[model samples]
Target: MNRRLPTKTIALLLAAALLTGCGAFSNDNRVDPELSLEQAKQTAMAMELELAEMIPDENVASVDQSQTGVLLSCDDKRGYQWTGGMNIVVQGDLDPAALVDAIIDRYSTQELYTAKSSPTPDGGPGAHVIGQHGAGYLVNQSPDRTAIEILSFSPCFVLPEGTSPRGNF
Candidate 1:
């Protein structure tokens, strides 16, 4: 016997599948209504700067910053995650391994921060650490090892009704 589902039923099933598969129901990307998009970007930038300061001041010659907005997932039609990165150029030698250890030590006393150094595929030192409100950073080294980047991300949030995600979508 040939059996076919009704069009309405098929549409409902498709919607359910998309919502589940696209992480619409996942709380991993928790939305904070109180966090505006601008506030999220600021949080990310400030955290990145704080993490960068973990390195010695004299060693840091200069810094550059970049920020971007990203959607949580395919299901996230309106929600956005603010990502920020600060590139630090060192005047003297800056040891990433030592810095990672220093960060771990610094955050140990802080209740909101937890830090750990991860393993890198290239056998170089890797770093991943978390701070308050799911704010975190991944330290990336330049291939030439002359500059270090503090790649940071903010918690997922939606822009308030009055705000736009950069005046573009």
Candidate 2:
């Protein structure tokens, strides 16, 4: 039984075994398969509302929360995660620099998130806040600085076993 197999055959077999064992080609990205779909949705919604409240009521124009089961894009990852997000727009005769400072302060004070500001190199619109469980917010302004846009979103995640998705499309 000391016969040596061809190198190519051995390599192919090794590759196949590695792929099968590691799930390298598997489409599911359920890093935490124990997480339930309802739990994920609840986290996303809670974070979305918490972020929305950070803005001053006077500056809020509207808040639109995304529906449940929003598909995660990237054809390969379509069914792996869902979208939980809220979009808000602010418009008025306001000082954006001051608003930005205020927002950053709010994020910093919040126990749920650690805040940071990422301003554009040329001082354009670019800033965000990162929170627990991939929850976060982004703040951007129109080129003309007439309107400021805000978005808060939950982290895309998969549900646990024994349960199907609400809407994975």
Q: What would the TM-score be for candidate 2 when compared with the true structure?
A: 0.54
True-structure RMSD for candidate 1: 14.1
Name the regions of candidate 1 deviating beyond 4 angstroms: 1-28, 67-77, 160-169
Q: For candidate 1, lDDT tens digit of each residue in 70-140?
A: 43321255566665456677768778788777776777568766666653434556466665444555664
How does each model score on lDDT?
0.57, 0.48
Estimated TM-score for each candidate: 0.69, 0.54
Worst 10 residues of 1 by lDDT: 1-10
Cα deviation of 40 in candidate 1 (Å)? 0.4
Which residue pairs in model 2 clash with each other? Answer: none
